[model samples]
Structures are given as structure tokens and as C-alpha cells.
Target: MMYTEENKKEVILFGYGKFGRHMYHHLSQGGHHVKLATMVESNYEEASADRIKDIKRFNPKHNDSIRMLGINPAKHLLYCAMEHTSNNLFLVLSLRELYHDAMIVAISNSEENTRKLKYAGADTVIDIYEASAQHLVTNLTKPAVAEAISTIFFEKNNLKIAEILLESDTLLEGKHAAEIDFYGRGLILVAVIDREMGDELIYLSRGVDHKFDAGDTLVLAGKADDILSFKMELAGV
Candidate 1:
């Protein structure tokens, strides 16, 4: 049940707040089925209506309403984006109690809350303020990289930057980029992070003759399907 950056997950967003909606959009755009749930309080019909309104504000064409906790709890990425950090922590605790292998991601409001969320068994805890500040810094320092990130996160297309690790016996280990014909494969090899060289990511502006090594990570930017094909080729499958 170890989740890696390469693993695509079906998400169940556990709130209808601003951050929850934001996560929903990103997950859906990333080709994941996302479901919404909210804590039931007071009148069930009223709470469901409120959640539906929040969803429609983002997706006007969406007519489906958020449901309660009837979702199959296992094998899903559970996102706890409740506006209240304490409530999110409680939800994480409850989810962990039910689904031991579920990947729970939570958002935190403060540094203390981030620690608390992690302690409460959230696999990943993100602080909105800190993430926003980091995005601002990247935009300021590395505009080109920031633009690439924005294209992946903000754009609705399937274009994205993906990383693939080469195994010792991979077919792509010692082949040059031109030998593999990246242009024909519908992708561009962006960079190579050499493991022997302290894992420094070297951008390949001219990698026709660049030889890949075992354990070297390939950074590519292209359509998601093309990236999958490249990974499969690397594995000689």
C-alpha cells in the first residue's frame, strides 16, 4: 500500500469548503473520479443542498449532489479539507480507524495544526499559506519552472511533467534520446537526474547522445498517455 508520486488515485474529498473544491477540480482534471462528502448535522436535506450549491459554484454543469459516508472506504485517497482544522483531524482519525491502508491527505491552517494532522495519521499535510508562499517564491526565482508547474496544475489539458525511474536492466538505460526517437513517441525528455552525481537534475537541451544510467530519473513533459508509453518502453514491456 505504499503510494508513490507516480501512483494515480481515486479521491474522495471529505468536505465542501473552498480548499475541498479546489482539490476536487485538480483531482478531476488529473483523470481521477472524485466524490464529495460532508459531516451530517442538523437537517440532512439542508446540508446536502448547501453542499450541492458549493459544488455548482465551481462546476455549473454538475447536477450531482454530494453524498454522505456510504463511499467504499478502502483503496481511495481520502482528502480532509474541512475549513476547521480540528474537524479535519477528527475525520482523519475516524477514517484511519476504518480503512487502515487508505491514503489520507489533510490541509492545515497553522504550523501547530500541521504537526497535529500528521500525528493524527494524515499521510500528507499541506498548509495553504505555506504552499501559496512557496508558489510565489518559485514564480519569483524560477519563472520558467513556475510556468511549467502552472501549466500542469492550472491547465485542463492532459499535458504534464512526469518522472520515471530507470531500473538497472531497463532498455532505456544506455540508449540516447535520438536512438529512441522521442519525437515519434509523443514526448520530450526534459532532464536527467543522475544518481551518481548527487542526484542533480540536468536539463537536456541537447540529449540526442545523452546516455541514461541505472537509477537515473528521467523528467519528461508531455501528454499523460505518452509518458505512460515511455515508462513502459523503459521497462521493455
Candidate 2:
């Protein structure tokens, strides 16, 4: 996918590493200026050109690069490269003084880095390892849950995980989410049923005491076994 000049917001990528190239092309094809920066442009060659296009290069080590190019407001979305997994907080924070309202997406190889990035004021800190691992697990084991889950790029491995339908004879039928603790027992309850207005996913523990209807479903999380056990318990299996 390539952007042929039709998008609105200009996007700037902080590095030309693998993640940078992926983010650049993904955003570019979706329509953005997609200025890709790196210590050198040679890293982004024809071999990887298919994944990137019209990338503006810069030197990562040059202070002038940060002064002139690293923090430009011309771009609306700035995706920091995550593949390098180095001191990205400093690089990302340096841009804040330059582009105040720019939407910054920081990618980290670990949860610690992700937390650091968030602490440093990145718009969103994405966990690259978490995203990759989840995708691998879901794709390899349960391809059925790919779309039901939110994009790993945005979520911290805890999005709308799994959806389940409840039967009338379930033990957890007339239960409230707050009554049961899913904080560490594995899995969290995101929504429950109202049983009337067509899939009205009411937030758990917010004071909706409606009993479980036959067609009602309870969405939950954790491992596949936990999810299934939750469903069976609710379905009276």
C-alpha cells in the first residue's frame, strides 16, 4: 500500500528501522506525508523500498537533525521506531518542545520501556513485544479471536478479549461483576448483558443488576481455559 498524495495529516517517523518502515508504510498507505528519519537513509534501500516510499532521511546522531527535522509540526502523527529498543524516551521527549500537539506513538520492546515512554509524555506508548507475542499466540492457537481483539498497537494486551454467550442454567447467571473478583484470578470482566435492547454491553460493576437472559453473553479474559471455564460456569456445564 502506498500513498499517492491524498491524505490530510503529515506523518513523521523517528527512525528508519524495521518498525519505522512498517509504521511509515502503514500510515502512508492510509494517506499521510510519512517523513521517515534515521541515522542514514541507506538503511532503507530498494530491498525494503516496497515497505516504504518517499522517505525524508536524517542523521540520528546529529544534533542539527533534532533541531531542524526531528520535531517538526508539519506532521500530525509521529510514530517512534520500536525495533531499536534503545533510549527512545529522550528522543521522543526532545520532540515535545518542538511539536506540541503532534500525536506521538511510541513503541517499546518491553513493558518497562513502554511505561518509561508514557512517563516521558509520549501520546501513546505501544508494547512491541507484547503485541507480537499476543498476535503469535492468537494466530497460532486461536485464529478465531483475531478480529474480536483490538489492535495490539493500541492496547496493552488488554482490549476486548473474548466474547461468550450465556445459557439459562448457568451458575453465574444472576451474578454481578463486582461480586466476583477477576483482578488476579485471571481474566477481567469488561461487559455484561441487559437482555432486552439487543446486545447492550453494560459496563461491569456500574449498578446494572439484570439477571442473565438465555441469549445474553458475558465477555471475559485470561487464558483460553479460564475463558472457557468462565463460560461453562455461567452456562451451568
Candidate 3:
């Protein structure tokens, strides 16, 4: 799905430890309404005496779009960044029991826990170590590309990378990637995930032609507005 400012998700983070704290800062700075959800609210004060001040402090580096939220079951997206994999799994399970439709993204520090987290009802499981190694590799081998990626991720801008799955009735079905003219529409078609090919996504830069099919997820990087518009166009919504 597209990730524009208007469509930015309201996320409830399940921990406030090192990883949780950093995630809170980054996502809030990125203009997402994020709330810290602990087993107890006082954990905030225990974790950081200046937690409230820090949360309320407006970073001059970021725009006024940064937002914070309280625990609300209505909030649809949950990010489980607990320090322990077991805790993360339990938290995901509990949240799943509460919000059946909630979109859960759980962080896994171990390979074994990754599958467990997914089976526990997390829609997506992120491996911290794997991601860190990938990031390090990118920085070491492709500094320029890494810098550009950092600008999109760390800095506040209209640019964003999003993955959108095409449904059976999508307007773009049956078309080739070259026929879509993504650049003309202000988007860079980065890759296409082929569902029928055992989850192997074809990157446009690989010099391979693709026939757009239903259930194929298109990964695109572009300005938030453009990305949202593209998603809408494909969905014919």
C-alpha cells in the first residue's frame, strides 16, 4: 500500500527499550502517529525520566507532522519491537487476540523466532540482524545508493518506497511493466513480486520483462502523493 502523509499509519509500539526507543523516534519523525504500549504506563517513567519531555519535544529537524498517541484498540497497526523474541511473540499473540484485523509487524532477533512470530499472527516479521547486515553491506559497497536510501528513510521528504499488491480485478492486470510508463506518472517501478514464482520478485533493473498479473505486488519509490495516486489508479478506486 502507498504511504503518504494522509495515509500514514497510527502505530502502537509494544516496548520502550533501546530498539523501541529508536524506532519511536524515527517513526514519529517520519510523521507517523506512534504510541508506546507497555504492560504498564509507568514503564515510560522508569525507562526514561524525561520520556514525556522527549516525546513532546519538537525536533527542529523535523516538521510539525510528528505525532504521538495513547493506547487505543482502534489503532490498526502494531509494531512489536520487544527486546526478547519470546516477549515479542507473546505480545503479538495478545494483540492478535484483541484486534483480529490489526496489521502486526513484529521484529525477530533470531531465525527461529522469525517463523514463530509470523505463525503467531504477525503479518510481517522483520529480522533485525539480517536487516542490519544488509544495511552494512549496502553502505560498504554502494555508499551512494545507501546515502539516497538514507535520505528517503531518515530525512523528512515527500519521497517514500512502498509495496502494493495488485488484486485480480486491478486495472493494470495483463499489461507489461514497460507499457505502464511509471516514470511519466512520477514513480519508479522498482520491482514486481511474482506470486506464482514462489515469491521471487523481479526487479525492473534486472533487464527482465514481466507480464503484470493479479496477485503481483509492485514495489515503487516515488513522492508520497504520486505513489498514492498510482495505487488508486491500479485499484481503480
Candidate 4:
């Protein structure tokens, strides 16, 4: 019984709180239509109703109201309103058995609540403190690399591509980029190529004169489809 991650279906995100807002922004930018549910209509408006609509009204205190939202659950659901509560486990158990084939993503600050969310059938449980800690570490230790990764992974509209190093007999092992026809490969940016160019330290797209090593990772940029096809074609080459 595999659950296909279908992007075409609707997603319902509970809790119009801070973490919920952040997740909504990410998914929305990734082109997901998100519907929100809140305990009160006032809290919903306070969270900025204009940025998002398609909200379903519900309250955490009222079991019936939560059940109503769960009965015909949206294809994807994320519960993020439990941060202020001590008995968040009870709420997860309350809504667990009611949803259909929906993928439930729960966000919790406590490890105990994460366990409860998993036990109650949440597909994924995110720990708030843990995520924050990791983010802090990255921001401190690797700011530049982190920014590059964010540009590629988080910014959906950007045409940045990060790829693993590949070595094959067919590839042009020790050739300069000026020798290769990049237009035929259809890459807008061959940003970096991992290479051991003696003391010169060859990085690609530094004007394309540097030679490529046999086992060098090549960072590139293009439309998602184009980059994918380039990788496939390069695999054969």
C-alpha cells in the first residue's frame, strides 16, 4: 500500500501560527494550494487572511469540529498549532483515525509530542527545536555554502542545479570547457567543477578555460527539465 505524493490534490494546514505560516509560504511558492483551519476566526484573520484563503473553520477544544475537518481530509494535512499546549498528544490521537489517505505532517516542539504524533499515524513529525538548532549551526559554520544550497533547494523559481560527481570512460576527462560545446549541452551556468588542476585549483565557469578532471562534480543551472535531461545525456556521454 504505497501512498503516492500527489501534488495536484489539495492540502489542509492546521494552525495559523508562526511555524504554520512559514510552511505555508514554502509550499505555496512550490505551487501548492493550501487551506487553513484554526480554533477561531479571529486568530485566522490575525494571521493575515489576505495571503491565504480556502480556510476551513475548526477548534482544537471541540472534538466534533476537528473531526469534521478530518472526515474528508485534504490530500495533505499538517498540524502545527500544538506548541502552546501540554497535552498535544491527545489532540493527535483525536484526529488520527478520522482521515482517509491523507499524508499528515505534524510539527511539535517536544520530543514526546513527536513520538505521539508518529504513533497517531502522522506521516512525518518535525521537531521545532531540533530544526532550529540545525539551522543555527549551518548559519554559523557554512554561511556561503548554506546560501548557495538555499538558492538551489528552497527557491523554486531559480534555475540552479547541484549534481554529484560522475566518472565514466565516455566523458571528456581532462578537457577545458572552452573545447566543449555548452550550447549543445544546454546549460546556462556550469558554475563549479571539482578538479585538481595542480596549484591553479580549476573551478569551471571561471571563464571556461580551466580543464575538467576525471571525477569532478559539475554545478550547473538551467530549467529543471533541461538540467534533468542534461544529466541523463551526460550519463551516456
Query: What TM-scores do the predictions have?
Result: 0.63, 0.52, 0.69, 0.58
Candidate 4, 18-125: lDDT as tens digits: 766777766666566677776656657865655565667776667778767654554455555544544355556666656546667788887887886788777778
Q: Residue 76: error of model 4 in Å?
A: 3.1
How accurate locally is residue 34 in candidate 2, as Cα lDDT from 0 to 100? 68
Model 1 TM? 0.63
C-alpha lDDT score of every prediction, in listed order: 0.71, 0.64, 0.74, 0.63
Could you tell which candidate, 1 or 2, scores higher by lDDT?
1
Q: Higher-TM-score candidate among 1 and 4? A: 1
- Report the C-alpha lDDT of model 1 over 50-141, residue by residue, as the tens digit: 45432211111121322234445565778888867877887777776666777889999889999998988898999999999989999999
Number of the top-ranking candidate, with lDDT as the measure: 3
Which residue pairs collide in model 2, if any?
Answer: 39-60, 170-234
For model 3, give the 10-residue run with minimal summed lDDT: 57-66
Each candidate: RMSD: 8.4, 12.7, 7.9, 10.8
Which is better, 2 or 3, measured by lDDT?
3
**Where does candidate 2 have its weakest 10-residue lDDT segment?**
151-160
Compute the lDDT of residue 115 as modeled in candidate 2: 83
Model 3: residue 143 alpha-carbon error in angstroms: 1.9
Question: In terms of TM-score, which candidate is strongest?
Answer: 3
lDDT of model 3 at position 8: 74
